[model samples]
Target: MAKLAESNNLVGRVGNAGDTAVGATAGIRLRKSLPWCAAAILGLVGVVYRAILIAVDVPPANSDEGTAGLAALHIGEGRDWPTFFYGQDYMGTFYSYLAAPLVQVFGTHWWTLRLPALVMYAVFLLLVFRLTRTLYSSWFAVFVTAVLAFGSDRVVKDQIIGAGGYSDVATAVAGLMLASALLVLRPEKPRTMLVVWGGLAGYIVWTHWLALPYVAAAVLLVAWVGRAGMTLRRVSLAVCGFLLGAAPLIVFNLRPGRPDSFSVLLSLSGATEPAAWSDRLHGAVLVGLPLSSGLCAPSHCATWQLWWGPTYLVLLVAATAVAVAAFRRADGGGRRVHAGRLALVAGAAMTLAAYVASSSSAMTPVESARYLHYGLVSLPAVLWPLWVGAASVVGKVGSGTSGDHGGIRRRVTGPSLGGAFLAAGCIALAGAFVVGLSVATGQLIAHRSDYAAQADDEQRLVDGLRTAGVSHVYSGYWTCNRLAYRSREQVRCAVLDEDLSPGLDRYRPYRDQVRGSARVAYVLPSSGTMSVNFARSTPALGVDVVSRYELGGYDVYLCRQRPERG
Candidate 1:
């Protein structure tokens, strides 16, 4: 009996030894993977820091940003979801939902309202790392994260806006990453993956309806690429998952007073053909290239600006060449896919399609630019592979292996290709970092005076109106949205013919009612067309000019008046 017990103990010891060895191996693998992990952490930190700087310096002052911020503020104020702001039924309940907790904890500070966007952006970076790692190599994952961290002009601008926060960028990026991760990781058991992907897709649609087409295209692409021998059961699961995830948002959208833009597009029956070739080509160059060029310049220009000189052109061409090469060289068929190439193609195709569809009749350059931004997130993928390839060449040269072409080839063959890819990735990432820093510094230096003046003028207007005992104000173009957001007074404004006019129209009927009731205590005119019209048109009501201030090329006028009751 004693001998039998000893034998059992020996067997137990052997099993324990095997388990420890497996665990030790896993630990070693994890340690070796720390570099990629560190990159992700650093990328997140960079996003957070950038968000903080933008929040501190810019404030939530722009009309779009302020509009969203105000809605968020209302939610923070314990208002229920889907509350009306102005006359429009503001259904941006998700952003408000996110802001509610922050407001509860931090009050209605601009930064607090902006925190959701900041958090979403950081989350986006983390998702990028995870998705890229799953689809590609660890090195490529780090490379992708770094590029997104530093390369995107829209991302930087959205971060700076401090209001729209990161709604559009965050939703699109996160949705794509999540969808891609599920597709790559669980290609076989697509039921679970489809549910996750569909939920994210629905959330993205809710966040930015404009991006629905892009999202749909991406979903279709994933379904096609990662088909994994789909059965009827799998197809049914996918369909059900998509419907389940999307139904809630779709129902909400279909309700009375909900936004209907997405529905309108769908009902149009996809009959809208592509735009003219000339228009698409022009957009590809002007919208894609020049807009990106402005990121390298001091001022962020949305159109063809003279600021982008020969150097900008050269860099643009070089980047384009690199992107083309990467796309062409990318292995379309293999066990390991080139996700970067797929993303680039998908993004470019979507952008081109959008341009063709919209620009067929009217040459609205700005609209084209805006629509193209949906696909612009894929730019990093296109550029990343080229940068990685270049870095590999540089590494080979540096290591004196360039002379031994056969040795270099052997080193880059098979699994070692991932390592060579990393060599290139590091260099490209460093370059992107330097460019981002340069652009950021340049913007700060060039715009310092303008931003400071705008800030001072904004504060002055707020203080001046309060001092003058003004309440129930009607703002002209200059103080239209600004005063409405900043002042405690109930503000009104005419629908100005401008970029944000569509949004402003949401309040038009209310403004008309206030005008009819003669409830306005003050009128503030901006030194622009709408303000000038207000000043000239409302003269019979006796304008008592309280103060005038200038900000960013617009003159502001604060006036006290009793509206002539009819």
Candidate 2:
């Protein structure tokens, strides 16, 4: 009986040990997956957020977005393989290419056209989460992700819009940051990684000129971190990678009759109008930063969300100060963390300096804020100090020195002041995010009513044109592409300038088609330059207006013949 009891006890002990090992392994796996799960959830949230914005037309579809959508439509039909935006040589057609398949499959509604931006934003969120986690902790990653999942009104607009390369540039910048971070931490990184970094840099060069600052910062980061291991072979490999990624830009420029995109970019980068350095600096610091940070609305900075603006500025300044202090005393792996943080700071500084010097800074803060969009990629690093300090303070408070009340008191007193400051900064940052989200949500709601009215007007216009059998017409720049795309080519319109002259038509075929029509119509806004020009020009051009219909804000004149300016 004693031997049997011993056997049963040993078996029970073995079973308990096995159960403990299984639980530990499961716990380890869960820990490993938690960050990714958070990332995936946050990414999904970001997509849904942007998708809702796109559906409601928070930005209201403009000519630029229409052009992008048209490009996708053309790509779907194999009408053209464009390397750059139709009228803008500096902005790549990558967004259109990405949207082509979606447009082809789903047709060209705003959602289908803007779906690529959603995917790009998801990628941006994932990369940002990974980058933050790598530099700091998983908790920091979640914080950053949550903040970005619902960005400020301006950030939401930039991310959700399909017009320009804003979303694409943001994603590329995040990728550059992650690649730079990896290289900084692992000096012995394989050559392939260098190639990838170079490729991303090259891609950014073509994606948008606004991203140049990020590309430069990323290159400098890797150069400094891998300076010891960098060799001619590695450099050559990077250059080759750059060439591979930039092949489209290079080939397009090298082709005859193509405008030099580089020159275009240069001209764009130069001053739009001369302004004093002080004014530019004032605009960048006072207006641009707040708009970029989402502390205030664009152009309405001083008036809207006034309280959060100053609070955020103070938090930003405090965080930066703490980061500098931490960097000075950091050691070991902490040194690497600070190095990464410094690189981000340097990038942001360079961006600010560039903005201050550029005439773009003199524009409305909202207009100029687009130039600062990529700087948001550095935000995680900028806010890292606050998070780290708060975490350290919590740890110190929780740590017990049993029977040493004096020691505990001393520990608390020593870090308490700084810890409180850090904690306050963090709390303010969280508040800023909440304020930003509220502003975005509020703006979206406000835009919904306007969007519905605009959409209804557009539909009425389309219906009138179809009912009148108007297959070809002349319209202003803002209406031409939008009308054509929305009508699904049922009523094609050639673009006319404000003066009723030949305007910048993106697709020449549309113009030719309109001009060749035996009878055409004129679609002009009731109060714009195009209306005045048409009313004055048609009489002298000997074009007879047989009939006129007022459709929404537009005047649709059925003309006996196509009007031409002599």
Candidate 3:
């Protein structure tokens, strides 16, 4: 009996010692992780601050940015919620609505409009960290966050002077993060998680109609994963939650005067015909590649040719491999699935869908970096798992014996090989980072002159128009939108092939009413249109060019039209 007690005590002591060692090791790891987390947080803050500085006081460069800024200005002015310059419905009013308070407080300042987007982007980075940490380890989470912090081109564009506050990128990031969280949380408590999943879905739809299908796929994935053992109550809860969250948006969408909203949703869902393959390919290369490259670059149009470098491709391949491995090992059983993996899958799907949907007959093989902004959130998610896998492999190989080897012998033998592999992987990743960064820097430097020239010309044109007693005007291409936003003038029309139709249509009635109304002061012709059309259209209406400026391969024509005095 005494011997038996002694033996049991010995066992207990050994177990306690093991537990103590483990706890100590975990404590050390946690301590080491703290600095990295702090660094990431600080980095995120710096990025946001930088973005605010760059965007503040800068005029909107793109039509989308100009339109969104205008909408926010309208909201600030206490105009109707959805109505902008021409009573046209703005598809993405969520960001505009969020920007309202800021607009109200700041009164149409660039920083005021841009601040909300900056904050949302910061939230997105933090969420990426949290979600990555929850699904993986701190190391992996930090790596993922770092990639996101630097890997997105849109961040630079939106942050930079004149890039305009592209809120859609922020919206897509937030929506993807929310969807990832819901998927990760769903497996633990089906009933509670269903509400989250449904709510996120609705929010995505409201945020950007483009993100809805991705959100839907995420929800369906959760349902499919949990279908077999899920309780009826849990299923019902999910459905109810989804309906509850989606009800408001649905009602708003169905409201009598929301044809634009309805059409946007349909277009995103492939109800509309796919864009031409050439056009899609062109967008993919021109916008997608450059933007992707910019994520690693220091500025815009940097090293335009190498925006999508080999490093991104390598990391993507590695990530895909790790994801496939992890997914294959994941059982339907109780072990909590990693949310990062699920997010990666969902993100890839969303990106693919966006690419396919955005393609048109005019799409070229080279796509635009801008259009692929939807996939920005997904890229890091996909990269995280591969990094984790590489680290794990290193740790394993360094431990010496393949399995069950004597501890001392294994320690001495394992670490060398493991360390080498780990070092190599890190070095490789670093090289890729350098390449991307270099390319981005080059692109930015190359485009600096062009951008500066354009800015100067744009300011001159706006000044001239405002000086000429032109309170409202119609122009086509980039300058029109820029002037409207910067000069706060009502743009009667824009001539562009892109989807500025909504903004342009606002001026149609004015154009038609020209015969009956006062004479117009200014008319701008688009470079995209033939000069013959301008000559025929302008003289017939008694319009003559008063001033012209050329910059960045674009010409701006300022015209004055004879007004009809009553």
Candidate 4:
């Protein structure tokens, strides 16, 4: 019996040793993979944070946003064809075409409208990371992308006025610009790159006229860089690709009696309000610094307009100096520093200059933040390379000073200025993440209650319209579509502005019918009604308000258009 017991104890001890060995191996592996695990967790958090915002913001906020969602609903029901931006042939029907399927599958809601934007946002992140990793170090890519994701959550928040309809389109165009810049930096086949890039530029013009400046800047950059290699065949192919991409816009606007597309572009182009230098300075500062005051109030951003110029100016100067110093040191330290590596610098610089020139003409009489909303990452994208060059200078120093040629060390763990640089970087990154992110996230939370109340107001207006037996509504171009979509098309609403007829095969004819003899009511938002201005010009026309609904964001009115009196 004693011998048998001893044999069992020996086997048990061997099993225990095997288990301990396995656990120790796992611990080592986990430690090694911690950085990757951290990146994944951060990415997941960003995605979920965006998702939560989309889920909570129930009603659409921007007039354009409502238009896009409503347009998609019409497309799904086969009531409309994929058409360009309502009233403008400058943009393509790409968003509508892409969003229509999702609308059909999920049903129309604020979240459904933003789902495509969310996916595009993810694509933007991946493409930016790939571009950065290709141009610089992996650690640098991770750091910059993390900071951008943290600070720019509002782009995904769906609550901004102008309704963020252009959010995904803007993000997608920016990603295309980055990818195009990457190709220019390392194009194996310059001809193919030209063709691809040209097609993209063409597509961007049709998607959003606002992005055209960046597209033009990129095309110009690539052409200038590849001037030596621009063969006749390559130029022809590139031109063809660009023309082909723009064919839809061209054909649509060429229909008999349609306004000349270029005329329309010119008409829509130019700044309505030329801001003074102080305003210009404020805007430029905004390019570098995201103040808390700049958020929440999408239209005014009154708080953000305060004196942040000095602060950002100082930061820019310091960053530029540090970056130059680091680059010079690294060049001396035997690292290959080619001036050609400065592709992003040229692209982004020109893009900013072009944007300023173009948007200067489009601003309202008062300084508005609408134009700056799309390029939240432009400054960072431009300046991050300097920061990278700065860090590389540190890395070069750390490598030389480390006595630990004995063992592998993490990238930023050296004892000297190497560690100091890392500390500074982490501090700056954390500060940016905290200030921009906290303000944005806090604004989103604060704004949610107001939007929720807007939802109630919209519902009451919907009920009032139904109660009045109002079969059709002629509302401001922006307001008409949302009221129509939310009412599930039971109320066929048409834009009161003749110029803003939606891009649809049936829209013009449908408008003619609705305006002729239908029992049409008028809906006006409290802010201003585009139709009201038009009505004042025609003294013969009369409008009488039968019922009015007042709410937090809008004052709704139900009125009958009385016949003209002699």
lDDT of each: 0.52, 0.75, 0.52, 0.54
Give the distance in Å from residue 364's predicted Cα in candidate 4 to where it truly belongs: 4.2
lDDT of 1 by residue, 346-383 (tens): 55555455545554323544323444444434544444
lDDT of 4 by residue, 324-430 (tens): 45446554211212122243444434444444454452343123333444454344444453454345534543322122112222245333566566557645654
Q: Compose the digit string of candidate 2's lDDT tens values, residues 247-353.
A: 88988888899889978877877566678777786677777776776656434565555454344345556655755676676554455555676677767777777
Residue 402 lDDT (model 3): 19
TM-score order of candidates, best first? Answer: 2, 3, 4, 1
Q: Residue 362 CA error for candidate 2 (Å)?
A: 2.3
lDDT of 2: 0.75
Model 4 weakest 10-residue run by lDDT? 332-341
**TM-scores of the models, in the given order?**
0.71, 0.87, 0.72, 0.71
In terms of TM-score, which candidate is stronger, 1 or 3? 3
- Where does candidate 2 have its weakest 10-residue lDDT segment? 401-410
True-vs-predicted CA distance for residue 50, candidate 1, Å: 1.6
- Indicate whether candidate 2 or candidate 3 has the larger lDDT: 2
Tens-digit lDDT track of model 3 for 83-121: 222333324365676777776776544556666666666
The per-residue C-alpha lDDT of model 3 at residue 21 equals: 100
Q: How do all the candidates rank in terms of lDDT, highest first?
A: 2, 4, 3, 1
